[model samples]
Target chain A: MSDLSVLYDAPGPKAKRNATIGSVVVGLALLAVLYVVYARLDEKGQWSWDLWGPLLDPSNEVFELVWQNLGTGLRNTLTGALVAITLSLLLGVVFGVARVMLGRWARIPVVGLIEILRGLPVIVMMFMAYQLLPALGVNYEPLPGPDAFWYMVVGLTLYNLAVFAEILRSGVNSLPKGQREAGLVIGLTPLQTMVMIQLPQAFRTMLPAIISQMVVVLKDTSLIMFLGQYPELLYQAKIIYQDLGNTLQTLVVVGIIFIAINFALSQLAVWVEKRMSRRSAGKSIDPIMATTAAPVKV
Target chain B: MNVIIDNFDLFFQGFLKTLGIGLICMVGSLILGTIIAAFRVSPVAPLRAVGTLYVNLIRNCPLTVVLFLIAFGLPTIGINQSYYFFGCSALIIYTASFVCEALRSGINAIPAGQAEAARAIGLGFTQNLRHVILPQAFRTAIPPTGSVIIAMFKNSAVLGVFGVSGDLLGNAIILTGSRGFDPVPVYLGIGFFFLMITIPAGLVLGYLERKAVILR
Candidate 1:
């Protein structure tokens, strides 16, 4: 059941020779592309020590300052993600349950809200919140951070709650009808059946997807830097690079950090999926990979 | 409301630009993504590794970082382009990873027996993929690819702040930041335009998904 063998026959002597040739050609091609990129950067004096020293050289005073700025930016990013993750999960469960369990009168509006939120871009929602919050007399000075921080949190939460709700709904929908029927026959109310049986099962089934969505939330926190005031990772990278004139190096560093965090989260999701599928004897539905899926992060 | 009415031309132009970017990137990503999918599924180990590395690296980094690398970092390396070009490139590159995944998943969904049957019929590797695997894969890939493209369109809104003028968000900024108009109406108008694109696209994709279901 090897994936490769499904596509073609296992190689004979001739096919093996051809595969070796193909591998060599592709390997050389990749190396050539890498070399060209390196050559171009080197030609532009991009390898200058002055540009790279602050980020790479620890003894320099600027190195410490740059790291501190990046550290603060990382903290701010995680804080915003943390708040949005918590709030969105809560809203997602409520709205997700409502969409499934509520009467038509209540569910339609919930459906409408989720659809509208899903349709609009997160940045637009953030800009709207940035403007609307102050107008609504929601003073920011008393809050823990700048006005843009709250704006970012609110906006991320709004969009993600819709996504999370849809994910949960899909999770529940994928379950066997027998689960709910059995609960009803056992003398449980619909709400009780949902809370006691379906909801917990959905949570377990959708945990991988929910975690991956958190990765999206973390990445989205960078968009708030566009608000021009929030000192998130990207914003702080901007400040450091502007001072050091090492835009490329600073961004590469920031990019690596983002990749590190997100890669860890994605691996966790894969691990959770594996464990859940094993525990359920391969019965879990992988909504994340399903076709016609919910609105996943861009 | 008055601001939206008065700046109708600007908004319209912005709307068109957003569509232009989305359409161009959608096509670009589809082509690139298909190529990457071929690489991933091909027998060559190096090609598969390259595809895996490219997908993982791009998918993990935020689109904003990708945009910054293209828009700002490229210039320092003497590869400057218009912000619009950079914006489109960033979107295409970022979106292609997800597109590749969607397509790869589609390819995987084809029953192993189908591929074996193709091989049994004396089809070569490329022939088996082109005639048998791909046709079925496209059917399954359509729904997820549509979702990815829709997400890409919404992502085009981020181009506004990156100095790509004449998109919906860019025009919204012109109204609020410079002309001193109300942000509420301006963003609302923009939101309406976005909804106009996404909702219809979603409905069509849903229809296609239903149609694509194999009776077997």
Candidate 2:
């Protein structure tokens, strides 16, 4: 008999019959659950066009306004995410390299900083930036974006930078010792070896991981809603639903947008991972460890 | 310092709530995640598809969106519960996706021969998984599952802002917003409490990771 999985052999005639029956039963159960959900929503008049028309109808004036607001909110969310991703990477590389290259005495404080940053929740950092910073006279006027934008960016950057740094550090550590020794043997200083040889390779190997972190940053920009006055997508969706009396529709739409964008980014990560593993073949590093090593504390 | 001392009761209560939520979600997600992991690895194609769909849809959407959907959307359909219940459900649902992936990976790491041997001995698929595979998989799965739970603890902080009061972040918000406490010490207190849990948990997880390494 042909083997399909270690867990099971290819089904014999009796087994195949049993499998088909199981499939039919499960399929019907799933369909029944969906029907129940649909019936409930229909009972509540949730299918009424008045609730969905503002989001779905192109000709409606409210539809135009809704789209425009959501568009602006999407733009702001992307702006914040883009800036945060950029800064997190730059800072991650700097601190990652420093942690590796610095003397033990110097590294201790850096370790402390990274641990604290990694430990705190992103929402806490966001609150500190949005509420605490202004109270302490840390003005945002010098920055180009709105105060809330900068706050969101800073909060995301602080948490993500620590995570990115840990990823890079682990990437560097996972490399063969020969690579580092050979650089030192060739008369390169440790810092030069790390900068010229090690860090670039770490970046290449860690690219998939870095991209995944970008998804986390993109998703986190939604938290700007709590900061007030920041018209990020979730916040704008709130405004839309509140104004239009379509809470369920607006959130579902926003959720779909988030799922679409983040799913694309996650797919990009998986694609990079496949390519990287192919290129390195036998020496492939585990990209999953790079992510799970330092938990993404969103 | 004065702000923290004055609001010690608030901080203490918040800490308990945060710990409570973390504990509840950890147990909930583990049980749910184990079931999903089984669905994923089952020989049934439809079951596998459902598992994959659930994991992907939940994992890609931000936890915040999940929270918003459950916290706001459920009430409209007459499934209204305490905000705390909604928050805990969202966290459990979101975190379970990651846990399922971790467990599936652990199962995949097992040698094919083991499962083949179980079936060669005339074991059914369920017995093969239960008696032969899963017991081994849990060991390999411990580290990643620990990381997921730790991340869940941090994520529980989000519930504080989503109308689930009495968590660490919620207390900080109250002190800063309505109580008019200085924002600096108030937030620092919150940060301190989070680190109190996360730092120690990280140490424990690290030790467990080393211990869990299969010698083979």
Candidate 3:
């Protein structure tokens, strides 16, 4: 059996420093928490530590209600992220390739579309989709919820598609000219040349960037709260935290949920990047590896 | 033309509200972004962690979460401030994350030695950051910041969704719902309104980018 010690081990100096600093940070954080409790109690006119007692009691109805809301919100949030991320990548790759390969005549229009849509905020786009499409008679009936969810998803698809296209374009542009010539010499059609040769290589370089951009789209889903229906996690948090009159307390759960989820997504991207780097690493060493020791260096 | 004249004052007021929120948040976020970026790039591990946590959380979290939490959640906590205060606060907070990330990107664009050189010349950290490192980072930061500013302008319209007293998009929604007018004109109007703010802002930012190049 292989020992996983090296994989699990921490960097020694960094860990030592982090441990000392982490303790102090937690200590200061506790003091701030105590202050918030005191301030909140004073606001309620009860002015006692007894209020925090209920928070520790897990079985309280209100806490249960909040948890139920959070659970549902997490489900919707995850589903929306999955849908949008998948669509965004597909659209991004298509647009990016189109942008790069467009003749001089068609390039400006595609590039312009990318800049304009990319410049618009995702929230505004969500509003347009939710509020605008129905008004314009573009209707899609989903399971009984005023079309806001679908609109939000489609809007996300549009905005992210634009940016992803630009990212793809940049990736394609960065490819050396030799690849294109080689593909053409092999008698491939222009479309085939791109589909088989250029696109895969370009996407390899674009993967990390695409991951970061997808995180942006995933986070942007929070704005769907404005469509007058559908509560993503943040909306659910707002509904509860507002009723409780303890923002710091409520946001503790909400913020941590966001942080935890986002951190996981980022780590996933990092994992992909690491795997990609390793694969690319071998490609990088190939020239030297194939050189036959440079004819004994003489 | 008739509708424009009929709702001239509402249109003008809404325009002002959008301008007010966008400009204030833009400035506020840029300032907050700088401080956060500084912390992010700091040598101290905990400080860096705090910075990382903040950027990562805000970046992955949606803008509306921060806004809704402030607009609805803050009032229940006894803050209950005016719409302007709440709207701007949410916007500033939301924008700051993007700002921090943008400025950090700009910082990353600068060579690592620029700060060390400034320090080598006997400048203090703050002084070195302000005088030497920042000027260069601002250049690298320009393209992203330009888009960020445009984003801020566009997002300002969402204040309507939060039920702000006076804002372009909310006002349009109100007009559409209550007045029973066609939604196209109003949305088209709002789109034009945003384009007015963003397009010029985009051009100016682009100009500044070129100007930075020439001056540098």
Best by lDDT: 1
A1-298 in candidate 2: lDDT tens per residue? 0132778877999989998898899999999988887888888888899999999999877899999999999998899899999999899989888888889899998889999998888888888777667777787653334677888888999999999998888778767788889999999999899888788777777888788778878988987777656789998898898899888889889888888998988888878888987653124544443477444321
Q: Weakest 10 consecutive residues, lDDT, candidate 3 chain B?
A: B39-48
Clashing pairs in 3: none
- Give candidate 2's error at residue B90 in angstroms: 0.7
Estimate, for each residue in B72-153, the C-alpha lDDT of model 1 and write its tens digit. 7667656778888899999999999989988987887788999999999999999999999999999978878888898899
How do all the candidates rank in terms of lDDT, highest first? 1, 2, 3
What stretches of model 3 exceed 4 Å from their correct place? A1-57, A61-66, A135-137, A140-146, A238-251, A274-298, B1-9, B42-50, B72-80, B213-216
Give the poorly placed runs of model 1, Cα more than 4 Å off.
A141-145, A280-283, A287-292, A295-298
Question: Higher lDDT: candidate 2 or 3?
Answer: 2
lDDT of 3 by residue, A1-298 (tens): 0111111123368756765786578558857876885686478654333433233347665667777887888788778878987887788777777777889889888777776666556766776676567766877665237566777788788788876676656556657777878999999987888888878876775566676666666676777776646677766766765676545455556667776776676666666666665653122111111111111111
Residue A25 alpha-carbon offset, candidate 1, angstroms: 1.6
Q: Model 2: runs farther than 4 Å from truth?
A: A1-4, A135-137, A140-145, A281-289, A294-298
> Which candidate comes out best when scored by DockQ?
1
- What digit string (tens of lDDT, one per residue) describes model 1 on residues A1-298? 2275789899999999999999999999989988888888889878888899999999877999999999999999999999999999999999999999989797889998999999888898898787767777776653235777888999999999998898888778878899999999999999999999898888888888888888889999999988747899999999999988889899999999999999998888888887887654124644345312555322
